[model samples]
Target: MDYVFGFIGAGNMATAIIKGLVGNSVVEPDKICVCDVDMDKAQHLSTEIGIEVVSEAEKLAEMCHIIVLAVKPQNYAEVLEQIKGTMTEEKVIVSIAAGISINYVREQLGMKCPVVRVMPNTPLLLGKGATAICPSENVSTRDFGIVKSMFSLNGTAEVVEEKHMNSIISVNGSSPAYIYMFAKAVVEYAKSQGIDENTALKLFCATLEGSAAMLMESGDDPDTLIGKVCSKGGTTIEAVNKLNENNFCETIKEAMDACTKRAEELGK
Candidate 1:
């Protein structure tokens, strides 16, 4: 819990995590280090978040006991290669890259390093993240506890089997984009019907938050909740019937299937 943390990519997701850690006092700014391909990005994070900035991934890895691989999936190989030698058995590599498996990272690092795979949604910026942590066998109980606590600074975190890690990519990691798309469409439709854009935005967003809160607190399943809202011949049922006619549920399933398949491919 007192260990230094380093982020390899000082981008948006990395920034979110940094802010969560520092904002929640999970770790001190000085104890957190960041490095990026761009020195400007690293320096910006250093200035904005008060974290230390290193010029190289290897340097960051050496200085910090916990390393966050926040880089893109395409760049994982290069970054891992650079820091492989510094990945001591005690160090924990928490990778945020979707579809990057723990076994794949260990092979890339050429050691049975302690690697934790996490799929966190962007809402982590608001400290309301839904993060799933999948740890390799090399990771100890303390490692799991530390990672979970650190992630909890931003939001809820759950541990799942590595076999379900890729599926989690679609569940919460990529689900934000799907929700955004639906929100955008609904807001635009409301605008087309003469509702003010700002009002529509606020209304829909709050509805989203409230709906999720109800789902979490109500102790009832989604179908039961939906039934409560849908009267025999009500407007809700009309819309639901339309959605069914258009195969909305089937479409969502198809999308998730594609997402999981692509995730499997990426792991390969």
Candidate 2:
């Protein structure tokens, strides 16, 4: 609660998290510091968000108690190497780099400093993100809770074992793209059927929002919900039958499998 948060990257995810913390009044804007190779990007956040901008990653690491490694996976080595010397067991490392595991952070740092690995989706930019928090053994319970609460303030945050982090990529991290692709197809189909493009997009997007709410609030299983939409011999059932005939479910499963596989590969 009374910690200086430092972000090692000024990218979108970092900006989103930083904004969430400051916007929600969870952390004071002045208590946050950010460093990025691109000073323009870091200055943008500082100028707009009223956070401090550090010239170097190590300076941010030295200044903040909770340091977020929001850099890209490929840049993790350089950033970690740059800041690892400044890191101590008292300081917490929160990593948002996809496919980078907790052990990887520890190994790269060559220390037993507390590490929390988080997988957060882009929806966090809109404060509707899904995040999975996985802390290393060295992380204290209190520190883990702080990390979890910080993410929860931004969106839905759940604790998950390290082993499941990669698999979670398919569930929440990469799911937005899947939903968008499905929406695109539906909107395109509607447009081809003489519906206005913007109207079709708006209606389909609203349908998606409403359907998600129904799944969460209606307390009905997906199959039951499908049944609700599909009457005994109705047009909805015809469409459902067509989807089933075309192995829609199987295709989704395969896509998820591919996503999980790539996540695993990236981790390695």
Candidate 3:
């Protein structure tokens, strides 16, 4: 708890991270501080989560040893500019902003402080997230380990290359939405077929969980697994055929491409 943690945004992601840090006993409530443009939000986190609320971003930057830039990508420049004077090489800057690079953050702050770029998904709120972490060359091994350990409280956190950070967004950062959309479509079709909505949803979710486990545990690749379930001309193969006919894989590749493109644009 000696390392004071300050968050610049009180949004859901920030709240989730703060909750993980405090709830898991990684940091005491008193060691954490937060400030948001919306006073109500800052107050809510302070009142409900038992953390201190600062009046300005600059003040938070000045107070904490580990500063997390939890604001949006577009807001990064402004926040960095405001806290530039407070930032020192000793302080660690952790950015969860998508599409924002460690170099961009260092340049914006006009300092060569340790910068850790993280791509985290909404599942962090449920303590079942996947996060990709990359750090600048100046980041110490100790600081990087702290960040990786903290993220492990939520879910799996992996170290990736900075060159792959943008591509990583499509894989984990925005994939939850794609899964939800796919689930929604399936649920809608079940309802249209007069099946109970809740039952279909429950079964589908369980199937998703089992499928994920199989993908991880089974030695076979996706195509091999598909062949296993898809007994020649069976119902599973029929559905698979239809999806293939409709360019399902191609469509997904295109979607991922679009996501990467947007991330690149945001970084620029």
Query: Can you write out model 3's per-residue Cα lDDT over 1-268, one digit (the tens) per residue?
Result: 2438999999999998989998889879989999999989999999998999999988888889889998999998899999998788999999998889888988988878998999999999999999999988988888787777678899889999999999999999999989999999999999999999999999999999999989999988999988889898589989999999999999998999999999999999
lDDT (Cα) of model 2: 0.88
Clashes of each: 0, 0, 0
Which candidate number maximizes lDDT? 3
List where candidate 2 sits over 4 angstroms from the true fold.
1-3
> Which digits, one per residue and each the tens of the lDDT, describe model 2 over residues 14-67?
999888888888779999999999999999999999999899988788889899
Model 1 alpha-carbon drift over 4 Å, by segment: 1-3
lDDT at position 30, candidate 1: 88
Across 117-175, the per-residue lDDT of candidate 1 in tens digits comes to: 99998989888899998888878898678778777888999988888988888899999
By TM-score, is 2 or 3 better? 3
After superposition of all CA atoms, the RMSD between model 2 and the true structure is 1.7
The lowest-lDDT stretch of 10 consecutive residues in candidate 1 is 1-10
Supply the global lDDT for candidate 3: 0.91
Q: After superposition, how far is residue 111 of candidate 2 from its true place, in Å?
A: 0.9
For candidate 2, the per-residue lDDT at 195 reads 94
Model 3: pairs clashing at backbone N, Cα or C within 3 Å: none
